[model samples]
Target: MSIERAFVTQPVPFADALGVLRAAAEESRLRILALLSEGELSVSDLTDILGQSQPRISRHLKLLVEAGLIERHREGAWAFFRLCEGRAGLVDPLIAGLDRQAPPLSEDQARREAVRAQRADAAQSFFARLAPKWDQLRSLHVPETAVEAAVLDVLGPRPVHSLIDLGTGTGRMLALLAPRAGRATGLDSSHAMLSVARANLERLGLARVDLRQGDIHAPPFGRGSFDLVVVHQVLHYLDDPARALREAARLVAPGGRLLVVDFAPHELEFLRESQAHRRLGFAAEQVAGWLADAGLGAVETRDLAPTAQAEHQLTVTLWLAAEALVAAGAERAVA
Candidate 1:
């Protein structure tokens, strides 16, 4: 006798559901909700916590309110938003899904968080003194136009698909090279620096660029993920410049280029302490050796701007190197 077969049902289409769910799935939005779940938050609190523009954060909150996921109340000139208790029917499921898909906080993430907290404190202190006289303070250093031109000359016009800018202070290098790349990620130890970088990029209306906070000696991304990597004016700040260079090399894809721009050897002890710089400067041969140790070839070192006077002189140099890719036939033979 033939038995009747039981029917099995297909799973729900997560792609379609996620599309609708993602309306509030943004990183900033999620963080806002999570924070608000604890208590009410004004726009300024969100700006400080998420390090986002007031307009951008407000837009996300509005979307959440429209979606019936959050409730907002206006008192005088300030507006506060919070997660509605029973009214948040859809938000519960979204939060549950987000919790499941959230990236784990590893040791590196913890370290970065500590660094960010410290940097935020330091930046607040620095800005408290310098914010009012920002123009004057900025003018004390080299002109931004000169720095931009020097960066462009160092990057050249080569096509770069995936790039990383280590210690990407204000993301100047990433902004310059992002147009020539398929994707770009900036890594920095200071959350304040990354915040400035994010704001700068957003002001330019740029997308597909990621900014992460982490140390240069121990970055968070995987090995060999970038087609081109840059460390601009950052080597002098690292405790171990050689180790940081090796870490940068680990992120370079096969045949990818690595460009380092910084000052030549010098004696700048005062700046080293006050600015938290670990080294004064690096030599060309010393940098080349680090690149070779990291499995890179075709190393080229050149000076960009040299000082005219003997006493009043500041020389800049650029070190370029590429990872040597192995042929498929050679790999097969060796295997």
Candidate 2:
């Protein structure tokens, strides 16, 4: 990513100035900008919050988009609206200067909070239905900040040409490690999860990321590419975990490293029945052998176990493997 520059808020010419002002002059349209500044919202979400008809909400959105005050993107079957960077610069300062304690806007802010609460409830229900035990196991581990810090420590400060995150749920790994690479891609199988990842990426302004829906067992990528490949907490969900590892290994460029993160060996049979996890965890030898079978050289492994104060804990293991620098031209790990 490049350096951020300040917004140059110059006045608009005579002809378009009126149009821009008119777009924000309406009661409904002004509130739209206020809500969007918080996060992207769908037409349905706006309709629900404003207690307005779909046609009326869509009409206001059309005017806002025409005025360049906001932008729209279609993901899967839903269209989401968010504030544009350049245009938002012109509007946000004025919005921030407004008396937020005013009558109608104060009430609108209350409604917005209610909408966000409802959305959070729905997201929790969705995840619980999909992987209850996995969520439970997540609580048993050491705090996530420590795990992410260890992952960063393992990945030295050297910059990379490209990186890929397999099973990139919520795009956290790509977001976490993207600064170390020139470009990064995140692949996932679920559309619902991809939508969540897309929103997070757009919110953070990480424009260099490319996302696609694909199976980890047969990733859609060129052979011997990607300076780094990551399989983070994905194997537990798959039936043929080795096949996915082999596929991930195939994408590692020569001299490149493959990082795998997952729970260490554990007696969590409940995960299989409740969370749809096919494997409880992996042994150091189990994953090391997989890397060897996939033609990657074993490097090192680290186990970050919880402290004595923490009961019902799961030890997280991280394994780093590499493709020999001389073997980039070799055929051992090619797709």
Index of the highest-TM-score prediction: 2
TM-score of each: 0.59, 0.62
Q: Taking the tens digit of each residue's C-alpha lDDT, what string does model 1 give over 131-221?
A: 5544542333455567667667766787777889999977788777776776677888766666566556644544336666678988877
- Residue 331: error of model 1 in Å? 18
Q: Write the per-residue lDDT of candidate 2 for residues 1-335, one digit (tens) a residue.
A: 42132356777677676777778898899888887766567898899878899999999999899898888765467777877666745677767776668856777777876766665565556655657555676788987788899999998886777889999987888778876676677889876776566555654666336666778998878998798999999998999989999999999987888999998988978778766778889999999999888998745799999888887478999999888563444545673
C-alpha lDDT of residue 129 in model 2:
67
What stretches of model 1 exceed 4 Å from their correct place? 1-144, 309-312, 326-335
Best candidate (score: lDDT): 2
| Candidate 2 local distance difference test against the native | 0.79
User: Model-by-model lDDT, in order?
Assistant: 0.67, 0.79
Model 1: lowest-lDDT 10 consecutive positions: 1-10
lDDT, residue 211, model 1: 65
